[model samples]
Target: MSGFACASSCGLIFKSKESERNVVSLFQYDGLRAVESIRLGAIRCDPKSSISTSAAKCGRIKAMASPTVSAPKREKDPKKRIVITGMGLVSVFGNDIDMFYNKLLEGVSGISPIDRFDASEFSVRFAGQIRNFSSKGYIDGKNDRRLDDCWRYCLVAGKRALEDASLGQEVLETMDRTRIGVLVGSGMGGITAFSNGVEALIQKGYKKITPFFIPYSITNMGSALLAIDTGLMGPNYSISTACATANYCFYAAANHIRRGEADIMVAGGTEAAVIPTGVGGFIACRALSQRNDEPERASRPWDKDRDGFVIGEGSGVLIMESLEHATKRGANIIAEYLGGAVTCDAHHMTDPRSDGLGVSSCIIKSLEDAGVAPEEVNYVNAHATSTLAGDLAEVNAIKKVFKNTSEIKMNGTKSMTGHGLGAAGGLEAIATIKAITTGWLHPTINQHNLEPEVTIDTVPNVKKQHEVNVGISNSFGFGGHNSVVAFAPFKP
Candidate 1:
């Protein structure tokens, strides 16, 4: 028997002479191709066989063909479901998830002057800075100075998530640690560390730079450090799709569970790029709000006088477990992760498709993947970063997907927490979970007047208490990356 392999953009497919057997494998790399070579001493096939002719048509096929190997068939186990067990967040609004939720419900704004570093000379000054986060409590004494701000945030958030899930060390010790995983992301990784490291390298020789510089600056270190701190040994990686970083991380983590690679995963995002360089770069691009006099009202998404987003720093982590695993351990399921979808605009590096074609497709795909109808969506957490074009594009997309339901309750959490960049998705996901669990929808504060172009009924001022069985969170970023996630109250 002869075997053939074909590679496509999505995956690789291998077909055997025995037509009944075939294997398909999804690949992360886009440039996958099939390479064929013959083994001289391998099993010889009849020269006149159809398999031999098939081998001749292709470049070359290995003579050896062990009984056609097939990939394990995916079983539709209705008993197994994916749910959110625990959530932890360190946002500019607060340190704990409950504090953040309460502030959101009260329509409090966290934007303020850039206090981390002097930004007086910059065009933009306000940002969402985590006020009272202390690294000493989360990081080890010896490693505190070596870690970056993003890692510090992830460590704290990850620990809190584990504790909230009641997965103490004693419990983890009994479970298969190898079956647990971590997927954390950051848009700018360690911009502060990178900037400082470069300055040190320029001032002194190579020896002057600390050995931890590279490890602290790379994006994956957040996930790596979380795994080390939490003793999780499953699939671990970090995604960087500009501001869509965390949403991609959640999507990837869910696939890991769906593919049976892990039973429980610690997945989310962390971002601490609120330094001088970080702020100045966005200011240069004119992508930051310049309402310095009234920083609180600067991030007015869908408002007529909206300027741009206020850079925010923090982390949000979620503990996701298979329903089977959570039930086996009697874990408290916070919400069910219905599913999510991601798409690229392929239009612009920083701007979204003018008509929001990409965003609409992503939302529709996410709803389809989650098997939820649009009318059933009770609330929407928008990616309205207060930018003019980006906000309108998203609004247009929401209208196209939700249709007459565009009047549904929608809120821009970024109005409260500022734009967390890569961490926005995870943080917003936590907000959505809280909305469903508490029956409260956070408000889009700071909108003094609605923009004429915006037709949706955006909830402003105080939060609204209502039954929200299903919620959708939208996150779009630079590079035209669009991601949408759906969450629902866990009925079971």
Candidate 2:
């Protein structure tokens, strides 16, 4: 007979009517203890039977008169609700949000030969490299020249996001700056600056290294710079969990608003890791697709011929505000930030767990936190990086949480933008919001041969007109960091 024990110092077991061979016990305790004693096929009692009678047989336990009760389900408070008011990005497609998503819908390939530096010696020679990015009126000439691309991207995106939120310089002067914050993060911050510093230290001396080396090279600098530029004194910080960095930032930023710590936040991620060192590091790990001949088709997520992820660089930022604050200010709402969660695989540094338990748990928690049912999620912006193990592993995890694949449509933004490392989740979140607003789901391009294991309708190779009820963006990173953020149209 199967036996079960209550996780309490006063352990007890009781059999139910459902199964004669199985025992069940339910109790609440302030602290947990290992079940040292288990009664197998002990006293048989109906669930409707008096609790006092069962406790009398179990011994040394005073049973409460109340039946086992579950915790009350949480409901979202409108005042504490957070909404997306603005989205800004610096992508290979362009800085314009609508234009960028339009390019995605068209199945345009941003991947091209790496022309920023001489990549002839490298095994992988292509990326979703941004071409002719200009800060123009955003930053002055002197600072722009010295700033690392990571900081530059962060500053521009953050400022533009504020502008989109109608919180531009003129509006900001009237509001309390203390209630505004920035939480942009990065996976590999200021790669170019760090690489240059190391090169200088080796080739010449420490004297040759620039003064801004340490300040610019850290992961927190993007948030720091944005906060500095905007004079925001609220909960400003950065979280770096590899590719899951942006979603982690989003989760934390939303919580800050919910907790009344801040009224608004500039939150997301930035990456400038397409430099020589960044490329070399991924190449060393054999984590890059080496399709030099057909660079455009390199990032083929869920495709049988996919080799590895292609590297990309960009920044994606969102202006998130408390619904009450946004309503009072007459701000334009794009989408609602329902909720998000973060989990770790606790298995491997570079590889995901084969069973995908951690990822599935993360998705479940995100839905629970969002107060959303599994069936409500009709769209998923997957973290399919085109790696052999990652693609199928994520698919397996997705299948566990979302039982009905027929209702759900999934796509990989990395298919066109490549893996943006820390910035991937933020960029994909923008795409998910666009899908919600436009009633169109962009295609997961380069699906010439679909992987047999991936059963979900991937919107293969062409955009589809699907109204997204609720969307969740998945972003997993090295060191087994898994993150999921949920969003939907703001319904009053």
- Cα lDDT, all candidates: 0.74, 0.80
Tens digit of per-residue lDDT, candidate 2, span 314-363 = 99999999989999999999999998899987865565565667788999
Give TM per candidate. Answer: 0.83, 0.85
Q: How well does candidate 1 score on lDDT at residue 55?
A: 31
Model 1: pairs clashing at backbone N, Cα or C within 3 Å: none
Model 2 residue 162 distance off true place after TM-score fit, in angstroms: 0.7
Q: Please list the residue runs of candidate 1 whose C-alpha ends up more than 4 Å from where it truly belongs after superposition.
A: 1-80
**lDDT digits (tens) for residues 182-222 of candidate 1:** 99988888776787789889999778998778888888998
Candidate 1: what lDDT? 0.74
In model 2, which residue pairs have backbone atoms overlapping below 3 Å?
none
List candidate 2 segments past 4 Å from native.
Answer: 1-75
